[model samples]
Target: MRGAPTAAALTDRLTAQLRRRPVRAFWTALGLYAAVWWLAAVLTQLNLPLDAVEMLTWGREWQLAYWKHPPLPAWVLDLLYRLGGGSHAVLYLASPLFVALTFWAAWRLAGRILPAPLAALAVLPLVGIVYYGFTSPEFNHNVVQYPFFALLPLLLHRALAGTPASRGVAGRGPAGWSAVGRERDWLLLGLVGGLAVYAKYSTAPLLLAVALLLLCHPAGWRALAKRGPWLALGVFLLVAAPHAVALWTIDFLPLGTPAMRAAQAAGWVERLWYPAWFVAGQLVNCLGALLVLAALALPGRSEAGLGNPRSALGFDRFFVLWMLGLPLAIVLAYSLLAGQELETMWGAPYFALLGLAGLLLLPRAPSRRGLFAALGLAVLLVLAGLAGYLGKNLFEPLTSGRGMRAQFPGPALARALEAEWAQLSGGAPLPTLVGSFWLAGNAAAYGEQRPPVFIEGRPERSPWVDPAALAETGALLLWREDEAGRPPGWLAAWQGSLCPQGELVLAWQSWIELPPVRVAWATYGGRHCDRPPLAAR
Candidate 1:
């Protein structure tokens, strides 16, 4: 007991260290994020998630807009892929990099709301949230949106408060127009806001929230009336112009996609249910996050030192309510009215402010004991998330029956298809594949064939494939294998309709399993291949 420090002594030491070294504390948090995610990425190298594959395939095409989503993630991935010289390992860095920037943004915002050590403490709960760790490896649009979302409020705060040189550099923007003082911050906000929108239309809620805040708060209204807001709006519009043009040229193709159409057709009951379901999903995801913050609420040594939620005043209170809360409310309201189900991943970037909210709502400044407890909870969750991810990677295949896209043997199937094509066409370019996006995308990304994918057996989705050339060059049509080793029942019927003269055969097949699973493949058009020639084997 002689060497054991008293509780008060230990608390004093930790508080002193944390308060004296806020920057070091932030880097420590960021270091944990990078190490944990990078380890998972390296260990999980055998397979790429569906979203990551989609980004890779779309990145290959360098398209202005993808069929289902905006182009930012694809654009960035494309650049990263090229920069990585086609190394898949480079893709792993994407999520963690964005997450680090997001955390930095959150930390900066927290500094404005709390003392240095407390600001660092504020971010711990958020870092433990699963979205920033487990789900981020996919590095989809949601992950891409994280930094922008985190940066938006911070920029808005600086612009609104006329706080100079705190959030962004003061200078002339891309338009070659110099903005000094308040206008500089507003200009940068516009740019960030515009880029966020380009990243995903979901960012509209944040922009809407900003608008509401300006209307509701007198100071915000005054700031908006100045040249800064207008300049910001102009910059935003300019940044968004290309996407708008792309949408127009295609008649807003995203709105007409099957998913959107299905949502549009949902009834009133479904509409109400969708947002309710989304809110519920958010709660589930935030369980670990909430637990970390709850630890901060435990009674500490001094009541006055414990910050109260009601103690938040002026801009901080407005920020918690409008900046953080309003966007979520708008998303829920829109989902309910539209009856369109929001995917759980869409909520990934929306909670970057959770830590700031946690700090502002505390009735008193956190005691050292509470701070350490919250950090412990956060570290516990981070370890759990990492363990779960590793377990899935290690044990998932052994169990079988699970057909996660990552577990698919895309490279082997691709090799098999290439050999099959060489046998049939005497080694011309593999040309194209007519199939659903998932199968075709995997083949293109991981398979050596590098054939273009015509989604859903339709040519329109693959504009890069020349219709005439594809006809001459031939194609492989594929579908997922059913439980019984046959193609899915509906695909079997479609195959019959597609090749009335030809029979669907198990042209190529591959398997992977700690337990054992297989994907079935078939050919449709090849030079040496004849129609209706093969019996079902």
Candidate 2:
């Protein structure tokens, strides 16, 4: 009998197999990513992220924009949640969908510059990317921007890089075809770019990058002279017009909100230190991708210089450079000047094209086995991440006695409160909920009929709420028991004066038992919601 296959032989065989089936393997990897991450979301999280909860409440009502961020994400969540029969598990699907779009767009862009197989392999590092992996289950504004970021560059790249004929792609179209292609590309760019802005104002940085490139780069200025760009502008304005009108007429500016509860630093040391720290954090986030690329370079069975970035086949270096580099530079400069505290997640979309960047610039090109190994490394990273996440959320709560937000029994709390409200008020979704966004928002999301949260009773914060109607219609108020005296001063004055209901302590939904979460509920409007129109009784 043949000797048992050696480790080296098995590895070679697997790599050879991967090499032959790169496109299939590429798709398989993406599918695996989406499936397992969704699994993790279902298994690990109970309460969605604060952003997700906020969206859950806002999503109930549609608009071009919310008081905070764009409305596209909310629109998506609303449709997805309703489609899934109000099950929050479906919310997890959005993250995977956004990430897959980002990767697919990046893949298509890469294919233009690299071989089809290598293009597939180029995006393998994305699996190991932190934002795309460990923290991906949360569907929020940052998550929503992923596809827009990828597509923005891809559309711009295609528009600027010229058509199949112009790029020497084996066929020439009829005369004026290139001009038509450019206009078509511009039209698509306008559509994607417009939606991107509608997703978040943060898109300004990239748009600014494009503007700067157009102003300063030779290739960029030439493109601006074409009528295609003006057409793009008109399209963009048309898309933004609704929101722009809203902003212009709205009483309060929604651009900036209250400061974060986190501490800010001052003095020269902090200014310099904070920006540097932000940059360093980004690099650390990118460490996994770097390691994957480094691994690809580690010998075995790969060719060197795959897809030569130096190829004369029309890869707009300036377009790629500006798109990839400027947004981060703008952020870094802002942080340095403003001493703005940077949350790593804020950079979520900055590196959507990182895999493409590595493929373009990294000196070594992996042989098929090398590429396979890199993808394997990416799979390992994801599995290890998922395992750790599951373990932490499931087991660690037992020792800590306090569960993370993911451990909060959101649906259970909503169920209990709704039952009490129905018995008292003859059945409705409790009208509305007030108090902290966390508790009230959670109740609003899961409560019968999915009521809305007043969000601290601030009309601007919750423009959907008519204060006069809220006062007259009344709302059931909720706050976490542990945060007794923490309500806003005005809300606190009423906490004492309003109908003070008792507390409900519910055990966290984790493995084994952890300390139960205590939530206090009360009603405002008149009596216990059974009696009608009076004032806070």
Candidate 3:
């Protein structure tokens, strides 16, 4: 140009300009994510009480399968404890990190379906509203499950985009076959699916959705005909079989006995009411965002530009439905069949998918004024919602039960509890069981040695306990006075001396006799005689 600047000179100029264009954007985003998660971890750690810490300390390895959920999240938390020197701050980082990775993956996937600028802007709103600023340690599956969820869409996109001869695409023949055969893409998909299932059994619904997508689309059929889909199926089965077998063999299969059946029938009222309450809670948790977004991004809506056939028939549309609908379907089906309630955590993956959908709906080439106005409005709404939620629940106690009293005081409490326990035990082995509010268990950041027993009047169904039996080992029971309701009487039989420390009620110095406690009765009728009266024991 202009007498032809030397090729080398032109190249150098372009490279320099590109270099100057804030390459740190990636690092900056990652840094922000890490910083926020670290802060949440610190805050969560500070709020946990000693009882909660005890559960984190001593809950066993295979203790993951239970009536409520699978064990992946607990296992991950255990790993964090080992890596972060037993810091809750470290454990807290997990969700945020997952959220960040999800955003990144979504951005990449959006780029495949949208223009670059639009994709970036679309994700910005989600980052602000759905993830970056929100905090919840109880969102275990959501944290880990989302990253994998995002990845699935990306893989699907690649498989579709690849040439017919590529390894992962569907074959040209049958409706459900893979084009590239089973060795590469199918196996990879299976592995990923398996991992997702392992992370959260809730992910099972998506597998069916994937199958549906393949069957519905020509490209998907092509990929399937080549053995890729079958390989994926096999791998997924292999990965998920052990846990599924374990759940059936150890948990559900055993429940087939007559005693179990009677117990289940007896608790039908609670089983029904609680599940309804759980569903209601989830609706409130989303704050109607799911409904609002559905309205704004409804298919065939000209205003949102989602009606375009190209967009509607593409992989993006399929993924959007899969991500949002699969979880809802699974929860609804499970609730109807098993009488289980849906919790806020169960719906986390849906939020992530919703965020992706939102990004896909954003208009490309918006005028500067329009862009600023739209972003400004989004910012305002998000800030208002966040402020309102925090005002109501974060700072102020929203629930009448244990509420926010369970947060560990971070370094202060950890040091103090360790010191106190060491002195009390006189170097003897510390009792294995500690009890606290559910939130406290999350905050206390339990170590390997002392696990916290959650005493929220639901021990039989508690994540820390065996639904089939009462804890038979010697345990240190910690409880908050306000939260000290019915104590497990079986624990009293083992009768150890009580130690009342600051905000902690420690019970039992020696191994106690585990009375014949009925799991079904305990779960349904409440913890009647399972715990002794505070004074009587």
Candidate 4:
């Protein structure tokens, strides 16, 4: 009997030792995330040109509802721009920081359910993928959204697993099992769900999925019959009310509105398809790899044995279905109901959640063959993605110039324009407009002037551009030829034959002199021609 007791104690000691083995997986994930962030920051800083910088700058000044996007990202960048004094280096730093944070959140979320090595391996595809590597820092909504999306799983874990007790009440149930009760969890779920909605209205469908999942749980029906879920519902409505009120007050409605309907009638499908393509395109990046792995790792319906089959379904299944399936469902439902095409950015939150879940699904004790397979696949995808990225950048002029100029290049253009403006106007303030809004925004910020005026063609169309206001300011006009087309009658009356001249040829009308000591000129591809004084001419 004494010998038996000693043998049992030895077994328990060994089990504890095995459990405490150092987690190399977490370190690997952290290292890979760091490397990816550094690479993206370096590349963005080095390769982005004047045009991209101009876009970011422009986005800041004309901070309103863009033709294709909401203004939150532009708003964030504008804040950063002001804080950093328009330094591209400082703005560039935001992207990598967000990326690193996203990865850290994913790793933490994955660690809750998976071993360290598996979690690291799961995140590998995300960092290794080219799409996430290259596009994350392009001063777009997706960049800011990624970190928030990564945090979704963590929040859910806290709610479902009961980590932050301040948010909800932890309940003990039968069989020594502990969880957040249906009533309390629903309220927490609603609050988080509302946050996602505020982050991106397109993510609204996730709330429904969460509700459905809760209802499907064993104690779900009984709890729902009580007051908790309803209270949660009220909380959701309260939280979501502001965004609705803003949209209504601003008269800025989404695709379901009358204006949106008219816009949709005119090639809305084409717009919707591009976003779909963008989503598909990300698959070539690290995000795509993890998604594929998660799909593979999903437990089949049959594999969920009879003993509390719902519990067996796991968070991975719920997450995938909620994140991936819900987006698709929303798109399909909207298309069917409202005949509106789905926007690509609408799926961003879902993809981020999928990335987290996929990493958690990595095998704890992968077979040698499985390990070899995963590595081979990862290498193959990376090479393919790199080759594609390089080919596009090298051979395709449009693709190469697209993201690069908007994010980094605009600053260079701003400096050059400032120098040109100084020489022509002698440091006097003048109104100017560049071809693209992005360019104009940068010029206004970096050029040596305050309140650079944009000429309004249709005063009613955009509040930022007011014809009456520009006329009152006595602003000089600067425009790109491609953008100028035929100047409005008022503009043409103001200056005859004032179109762009010389090798630069920015637009039909380049610059105008409002009066003495005030001059403006627009440049094309960084080239601007100096004009003799108006009296001299």
Name the top TM-score candidate: 2
lDDT, candidate 4, 334-407, per-residue tens: 55455444444445445554544554344334333333445555556655655554444443434343333323
In candidate 4, what residue range of length 10 has the lowest lDDT sum? 508-517
Clashing pairs in 2: 302-367, 303-367
Q: If scored against the real structure, what TM-score would every candidate get?
A: 0.83, 0.89, 0.65, 0.65
Model 1 agreement with the true structure over 35-91: per-residue lDDT tens digits: 778878767646677888778777778767666778889888878877987677788
In model 1, what is the error at residue 171, expressed in angstroms? 21
TM-score of 2: 0.89
Top-scoring candidate (lDDT): 2
Model 1: how far residue 169 lies from native, Å:
23
- Once fitted onto the true fold, the runs of candidate 4 whose alpha carbons sit more than 4 angstroms away are 1-68, 128-131, 162-199, 214-242, 253-316, 336-349, 355-364, 379-412, 423-425, 429-435, 445-466, 483-537
TM-score of 3: 0.65
Indicate the residue-level lDDT of 216 in model 4: 70
**Residue 315, candidate 3: how far off, in angstroms?**
4.7
- Which is the winner by TM-score between candidate 1 and candidate 4? 1
Candidate 2: stretches off by over 4 Å: 1-21, 163-180, 258-265, 299-301, 304-314, 483-490, 493-497, 526-537
lDDT computed for candidate 1: 0.70
Q: Write the per-residue lDDT of candidate 2 for residues 285-395, one digit (tens) a residue.
A: 888888888777666644543444445244444455668789988987877777667776678888888877776765545755666567567768888778877877677
